[model samples]
Each structure stands twice: as structure tokens, then as C-alpha cells.
Target: MLAFYPRFIRTFDDLPGQLSLLIHAWNGCNMRCYGCHNADELIAKPPKDHLSGAQVVERLSGYDAMFDAVLFSGGEF
Candidate 1:
């Protein structure tokens, strides 16, 4: 199984028609839900560890030319 990261790029094997990248927005969430699938990792993240929105945008821009679409993934974008 794939270990999840707060933010990273992944290419899908099942998506249709175009080459896409999946980017997990961050390592945390604030809304606590019952039986949360990813709450453990989300809540435990240090606020200082992830990139800012501007940083994410700058990084992905380089790959936008190569990918058909960029999917921003995570609890909240």
C-alpha cells in the first residue's frame, strides 16, 4: 500500500484520457469527524512543516506544461 504524505505528486493509473498529477495539499485538518479516515496524521502535523499556497503554486507551475491537470488533494485546499 502507498504511505500518504501531506504533500506530494502522484500519477494515476486509473484516471481517464489525460495525464494528471495528484497533490495532497497539506498534512492536517481542523474538523474532527468520527471514524475519520485520515485524522490521525492530519491533527498531528506541525504547522511549520508544509509549504504555503504560493509555494505550491510556484512548484506546480513547472509541471503544468507536462500534465493535463493538477488535482489539489487534502482535507481542505
Candidate 2:
């Protein structure tokens, strides 16, 4: 129910292709698979103030034309 844009992409000078926005949906995951890089953080409780889906869309409205796709990430449970 929450998402965040964690990357700061200022330009496409050194990029290879069209850009995609990565939305970190930190809603907590319990999988805890071995070798998982985000195991510790994802297992912890998420904050109550995280932005809703609507809020995320509204906040990124101005930059609509910047990216070609929106990639929802994080959370495995």
C-alpha cells in the first residue's frame, strides 16, 4: 500500500535505454530466503507514515514524461 522513488536520475547522458521508475513498496516481507540482501530490513516493521499508491502517483505527476515504465519493488509476503 506504500511506495517510494529511491533513485535520483538527473539525466540520460550515460544511460543505455529508456528509464523506468522503481517504487519501493516496503510493506514488510517474511520470506527471509538465504543470501537475500534485504532480509534484515524487509523483516522489520514498516513505518505508518509511508505514502499510499494515490499519493505516489500524485507526487510523480509532474515527472510523468521522464520514465517509460513504473517498476513496483520490495515486499515478498
Candidate 3:
């Protein structure tokens, strides 16, 4: 079986009341919609450093106790 990996460019909304993590899955996007911040990152394929599903779970597992929920954004599946 293949190994799992997870990568996030950065996180936001790290306030005391709301503990949320913004996860960036793939940089490769099929659509070129307007007002897109990750336009540059989108390509034919996501970078090798891109995170995987299992990796994401592991990263967020630690925050499960502190955070209410994880918000996944950037790049469409």
C-alpha cells in the first residue's frame, strides 16, 4: 500500500474562541474561476509536498481536543 502524506501552506482563524485549521489539499485545479487566491499554485498536478488524507487526519488528530472542527479549503477535488 502507498504511504499517506499531508501538507498545508498556512493556517488562519487561530483565535481563542474559534480554533480552525485551513487545509490546502491539491494545487491543481480544473477551473480558472475568478477571485481565486490559489490560482498560481494550481497546475497540472499538485506538488510532491502536497498532503494526503491519512496525513491530514494525523495532523488534525492532535487538535481534535482543542478545535471544534477542521475547515478544508483551496483546490477542488
Candidate 4:
């Protein structure tokens, strides 16, 4: 199983399709629905740990040439 991270960024090379950056927007959720995939992270993440807009952009700067699209993931905005 893959361990979750609040700002997880990943890329897949073997998969067919446009190259993309998979970014987990946040490690949080507003509901406690049964069997949620991120249940553990939702309960464990601290709000203060979330990255600011500038930080996210900085982190993604190097990826500009690496992907053809950005796929944002995570629950809640």
C-alpha cells in the first residue's frame, strides 16, 4: 500500500496517456464516511501543516516540463 502525504506529488511513466502530475491538494476531509480511503490521514493531519499557495507553486515549478497536465486530488477544497 502507498503511504499518503499531505502534498504528495507523483508521476507515472509506463501508463499510456499524457504525462501528468498527480498532486494531493490536502490531507483532509469534511465527512467521516465509512471506508474512506483517506480516513487515517484525515484524522492525523494538522491544519497548520498545509502548504501555502506560494509553496505549492514553488514545489511544482520544477515539474512544469515534466507533465502535460496537472491532476489535483483530495477531498474538499
Candidate 5:
């Protein structure tokens, strides 16, 4: 499976001191729904470069003081 995703999706929140992080697990989906932009690489397993749980926590930890909260989004969370 391929591992690729956008850096972040814009948020609509108007609150101050807020930051959003869009993390892609890169775990391909089983569904074959039409019009899926990521359909080409859909599979049962995630790519070898997919970040582990600990790595994810560590990645988010860096933004602890800068962001109020982090949002996890992907084909599934």
C-alpha cells in the first residue's frame, strides 16, 4: 500500500490559540466505494512506513504547548 496524505485540512474554528493536526495512519481501507481519491492503494494492510502508536504520541507531543488539541483523521481513526 502507498503512504501519502495531505499535511492538514483547514479548520473552521474561530477560537484563539488553536491548532489542528491531520495525521494519516496510512492504513488502507477495505471499501471500494466509487470516487475514492485513494482507491488505487486500498488494501488490508498499512504500508511499512506507517507511524506506530508511540511515534504518533511523540509527534503530537511536540505541539503540546502550541496547540489546544489535536485531531486524528484518516480513512478511519
Candidate 6:
């Protein structure tokens, strides 16, 4: 894993009526797709405030009831 910070909670308009939590679990990328918005940050250095896998799961578990689905976002999968 590149980096992790699981304390954040965000809602996105996926398809007008659908809303989901956008999980930002990692940073930096290897693919480097053209015109990607995260290219700058991904190419730079990984964040120092990242979390561990167990911590990520624990943090996410706190908001389990608030959302029906999750979206693993940021950089590569």
C-alpha cells in the first residue's frame, strides 16, 4: 500500500440519486494516466499522516451504518 488516512467521510453524487462514501486509502500512482487530476500529488511524495490497514478498517467501521456502499478512490486501485 502507498498510504492511508481513513478518518475522512465524504458523500458523492454517483448517479443523481445514488450517494456513497469515497474512501481515500492510498496515494501516489504507478500508471500516471494523462490529464489525471491527482498526477501532481501522486508523483510527489507520499503523505506522512497515512494510517495502517487495521486502523483503516477500524475507522471505517465507525461509519458503517451511515452508508450503503463504498468507493475506493484516489490514485490507483
Q: Whose TM-score is greatest here?
A: 6
lDDT for each residue of candidate 4 in 8-50, tens digit (9 for 90 to 100): 5456652457776765555454566677665565466544556
Shift of residue 44 alpha carbon in model 4, Å: 4.4
- For each candidate, give its TM-score against the true structure: 0.55, 0.55, 0.57, 0.53, 0.49, 0.64
lDDT of 3: 0.56
- On lDDT, the leading prediction is 6
Which 10 successive residues of model 6 have the least lDDT summed? 37-46
Which stretches of candidate 1 lie above 4 Å from their native place?
1-7, 30-48
- In Å, residue 75's CA in model 4 sits off its true spot by 2.1
lDDT of 2 by residue, 1-77 (tens): 44543332343333447576656665555455678654554445445556767877777889878787666656552
Query: Model 5 compared with the native: what TM-score?
Result: 0.49
TM-score of 4: 0.53
Candidate 3 residue-wise lDDT, 1-77, digit = tens: 22222544334454456656666556445466687776565444446665567767767676667655566665455
Q: What digit string (tens of lDDT, one per residue) describes model 1 on residues 20-76?
A: 787654545445667865455555654446666667667777666788777755565
Superposed on all Cα atoms, model 6 deviates from the true structure by an RMSD in Å of 2.9
- All predictions: root-mean-square deviation over Cα? 6.4, 4.8, 4.5, 6.2, 5.9, 2.9
- Alpha carbon lDDT at 58, candidate 2: 79
Q: Which residue runs does candidate 6 get wrong by more than 4 Å?
A: 6-9, 41-45, 75-77
How would you encode candidate 5's per-residue C-alpha lDDT over 18-65 as one tens digit per residue? 665545546555455567654554343435555566666766676677
lDDT of 6: 0.63
Alpha-carbon runs more than 4 Å astray in model 5: 1-17, 31-48
Ten residues in sequence with the least summed lDDT for candidate 4? 1-10
Better of 5 and 6 by lDDT: 6
